[model samples]
Target: MASKLGVSIVAVLATSVGVMLALALGLISLSIAAGIFLVLLVAMLVFHGAAMDFTSGLSDSEAFQKAVEEKEQREAEHEEWEKEYWGEHHPDYQGEEHH
Candidate 1:
């Protein structure tokens, strides 16, 4: 969701620049530029809705849950490994453990 929104923001900025350049170069008139801008706006809204729908589907998916669990397990394993490695190497190591 956040990724889609960020991409949409970037797309909007790119579209704005394209429109401005086209108008400045006399390649497109003001009316045409307005239409193009409106189209981009509509496209962004549609993309956002689609992204939300796709994310909602994944939220309840078993595969997604399994992947999340695996990630957490791996992180825990890495933390354990880090503690052993750092604890042995630095006798006076009193740094905070990874959270």
Candidate 2:
């Protein structure tokens, strides 16, 4: 999902640059450039909607659930490791709040 958005953003930027270059070169008029930009915007929106629908469907699947659970478990393990590491490395640290 994030990658899709990133790609779309890149595409929009590239298109904008291309359109600007074309307009500067007198290859396309301002009205034509605006129309092209509008079309690209609409296409990006449609792609975003489709991507959302696809991701929503995946979220309800067993594989997606398992992957999420695995990710959470790994994060918990990493947190525990970090706490132990800090405690051992800093003897004066008591893992408490300081005022």
Candidate 3:
């Protein structure tokens, strides 16, 4: 698929960069070392963001509010039904029970 192709492309590019740096600097220069480290760091950042959406909780607030409202509505309806159907016959009711 497209995703596989993209990954393969990135891999090839990164490998090419690493190999060229190794060849140019004999693997001991600060510039090449820093470049490799930066590339790795960026790749890690992209991976983390893609997997977990590390956006500081911005996306879930509205959905959380909607869920809370729906739960409250369901609880209110249940309470109303309980009052209509069982309030008189509930054992804790102080006055009487229907025979």
Could you say which candidate leads in TM-score? 2
lDDT of each: 0.85, 0.85, 0.68
Cα lDDT tens digits for candidate 2, 2-99 = 98689888989999999999999999999999999999989988998888887876555777889989999998897777768778887676655333
Steric clash pairs (candidate 2): none
lDDT of model 1, residue 97: 65
How high is each candidate's TM-score? 0.48, 0.51, 0.34
lDDT of each residue in 21-71, candidate 1, tens digit only:
999999999999999989988997898788878777656677789899999
Quote the lDDT for 67 in model 1. 93
- The sequence of per-residue lDDT tens digits that candidate 3 reaches over residues 9-97 is 68857876776678577865767667776777687667656645534443577778988999999988977776666765674653333
Q: Give candidate 1 regions above 4 Å deviation.
A: 56-99
Q: Whose TM-score is higher: candidate 2's or candidate 3's?
A: 2
